[model samples]
Target chain A: MDSTPEFVRLWTSHQAEIRRYLFLVVPRARDAEEVLQDVSVRLWEKWDQYDPNRPFVPWAIRFAYLEALKWRQRQAREKLVFSDALLVQLDASYEEEVPFLEARRRALQGCLRKLGDNERRWLWLRYGGHGAVKAEAVESGKKLRKVYYALEKIRVLLLDCVAGTLKQEGWSDA
Target chain B: MLKKTSRLDVLLGRAAEEMLSPEEATELEEILTRDPEARKRYLQYLDLHAELEESFQLHAVAGGLGSVFFPGVSGWRLWTGAAACAACGMLFASVAWAYATPVIQKAQRRTIFTENFEDRLAHQPTGLPRAPGAWSGDDASVVGAENGVLPKTGNSMLRFLRSTHAEENTPKSAWCDIYRLVELSTPPALGSRLSLSASFAVAPASDGEQFDIYVGLNALDTYPVQAPDLDTARNLSNTTLGRRLPATRNGKWHELSVDTQVSPQTRYVLVHLAMLRRVPGPSPSHVQFAGHYVDDIKLDLLPSNALPVKTP
Candidate 1:
């Protein structure tokens, strides 16, 4: 197994895309993360099989897809999830949207800066920390229902702000 | 005025948090099937959710998250910062390799001289000078006949033709020598290695004709005044580097290369492209034609690093 610097760099650049691809197919985030870890070890073990002339993401994704199928088979008795056909369609859709997602992510920085202090604090509380909603509700002295509602409101505002910014930059749904 | 939260918004929010009940999941799926706008909004929200998760991990470690409500940001900042730095370093290293690798390869081995014969014609009109760099013997001619064997690269090449008498059972030989002299700005130091190579093709009209290559090097003063025979060629110059004899006479181009060390007294490099034949007794009942074609000659002075170190 070659763990050369070039191979490692190729793996690092595509790690996030591999994770998202696995997550889209797997039923649960925990299972997706486990598949991601397995895929990483398997890629390193089979690194010799990789052809450097080809693009790395599609090659790595082929391995990730196989690993995800294995994980799905192991969890077959669990709740129903996306079928293989649907997963393929979703994967294609996600790849098509990658450029748009990148633009959205960049626009997010400016939108984030425009958020009110209270809104930023809410985001940091819900996503910036590893705490349950109940814990967050208790800490903020708000009802659990109100905390969920506030978090939802914050997401809506950020989504609208991002859409507005994208439109200004010539982004269109079409 | 605050906008009322729609059912699609509630469903998407629960889906992002992975807390959607089975009934809500069914409802959301139905809505996505019925409405393209709902599906687009769902994808948008999901991407934003994932992006926020990534950003939190990135900024939380830098202490760039300016919120006190999120505890443990400092610890996350420390570990995340180190990982980001390592990743960036690897990325830069890969970029450096992508840009600098070709330059290094080109520098390590340079081309000292080359000839593709583009300037020469296989059959020139009378009174024109021969190709500037090439010198051919009296028996040799440039064969640019349209029906003859084609050159390996350009339109022309040096050619040598030999025909045999039908009844001369004794072994007979015929050959032609073509050479070019390459001048270097500085004489190579003793023991420096140089490579000489060329491409050749042969079409033997009969079974007895064969083609061969003989390479030679000499000082400028004693360079051959005329084409030398095989025996005289071996003894003529500062060095008779080597020879390559092909096994087959099928009109296909073959490359031959020889590596030799530079002598301290060497001033001129002469590359000889020779075609030789041996016809056995009782040759054909009719005259047979055998021709040789040559092109793309090169002599490279290999870098010192590429050469094997000489024993002291």
Candidate 2:
């Protein structure tokens, strides 16, 4: 806890992951940052709450979930808005990404290199934003379905490459 | 099982992005409970989704945005950022695993509540001397078993409208949401009048009638404590009465304020604006009826009885 340098380092390394976790949990971009900041502050204040032995992701998730709930509650009282069903839906949607991010990223790097330039760009465009796809589809004069299928094929190729790399990396257990 | 796992993976991906159908979601939940390995795989997949999201973060754009694999960049920066994020992660992990005590947890929970209160206040409408957005229908029938006024039932400030017609179809006196009644532990000191300086949109129904605004003490009075009606309410020299602003072209925000006098007797003083429509007229459908998007409302509560006015 005394090591400010260590804390800053930790924040840098996991900031992306924390941001990702918050993005999954929060609907708005701004809210995700707020959650991340709140989580960081809470982590700082309650440094004693952490056990050095455990993984950080789960703990961060717990904090993120708590923040998300508080966000919901605030929305409820101030706006007196949101139906129970919508709340349930939002909760269900928030944290669906707990398990495979690291391995997949590791796997994806090897496969992403194998893609053709166009395919890589296609992947980037498809995953970029809905606007990107709409723009690309119009420019290419291609049906949305065709663009979707092409993207899916590229994703499958990448997944296959990743799986092959994992095998080479001795992840036979997976 | 493999087929089920495959389907789970696809559904899980969609679910991470909140594009899953209801039926697919139900299946996914069932798989989560019954299959541990599948659940593990799903969690791993969620991590991937997180990575994808992080890749586009603004901070990720540091050192000139381009591809993740930009050439001529010092490897040290990557290592440093990685080390920093990892250290932050570990510090957080240590705190969560080691130091979290029950006493600390309770205190943290209270702090969370307080912060939540402040954060929420940013978007909440201020209550009047009585309370902002208080229901004013007749409540003499529900007499209290104890001292003070019997608590009002139904038509609570927080209510879920079943449909647009729920208000009209429902009984006029129906309490929309129930409030938790609490007896004050000590003498309830009069809170100072909140200096209201915020915009509130007031869109009347198609009939062009406006919602009524009031400042009053308690809920039983047929009229407001300060302003009996709109014209009278507007004419008060000392009061902070505002003319209703026009609707936004694409729903622009509005602001209003009231720095009224408050006293210990002002147990229930308030400034309220009701979105009322003419009988058989166009109903101000939804929250838009009150002529404003009341969400993301902010209120600053002043110290109690800090009114500048000298009461006679």
Q: What residue runs in model 2 are displaced by over 4 Å at the alpha carbon?
A: A1-9, A21-34, A48-62, A65-103, A128-130, A143-153, B1-6, B21-24, B53-312
- Compose the digit string of candidate 2's lDDT tens values, residues B107-128: 1100100111112212122121
Candidate whose DockQ is highest? 1
- State the displacement of the C-alpha of residue A113, model 1, in Å, after optimal TM-score superposition: 1.4
Against the native complex, each candidate's DockQ, computed on alpha carbons, is 0.09, 0.05
Model 2, position A103, has a per-residue lDDT of 45
Q: Note the chain A TM-score of all models in turn.
A: 0.81, 0.59
**What lDDT score is found at residue B205 in candidate 1?**
57
Assess each prediction's global lDDT (C-alpha) against the native.
0.58, 0.39
Estimated TM-score per prediction? Answer: 0.47, 0.36
TM-score of 2: 0.36
Please write out the lDDT profile of model 1 over residues A80-118, one tens digit for every residue. 454454455555565445446655777788888887767
Per-residue alpha-carbon lDDT of model 2 for A131-165, expressed as tens digits?
46556688779997667556545544555566577
> Evaluated with TM-score, which candidate comes out highest?
1
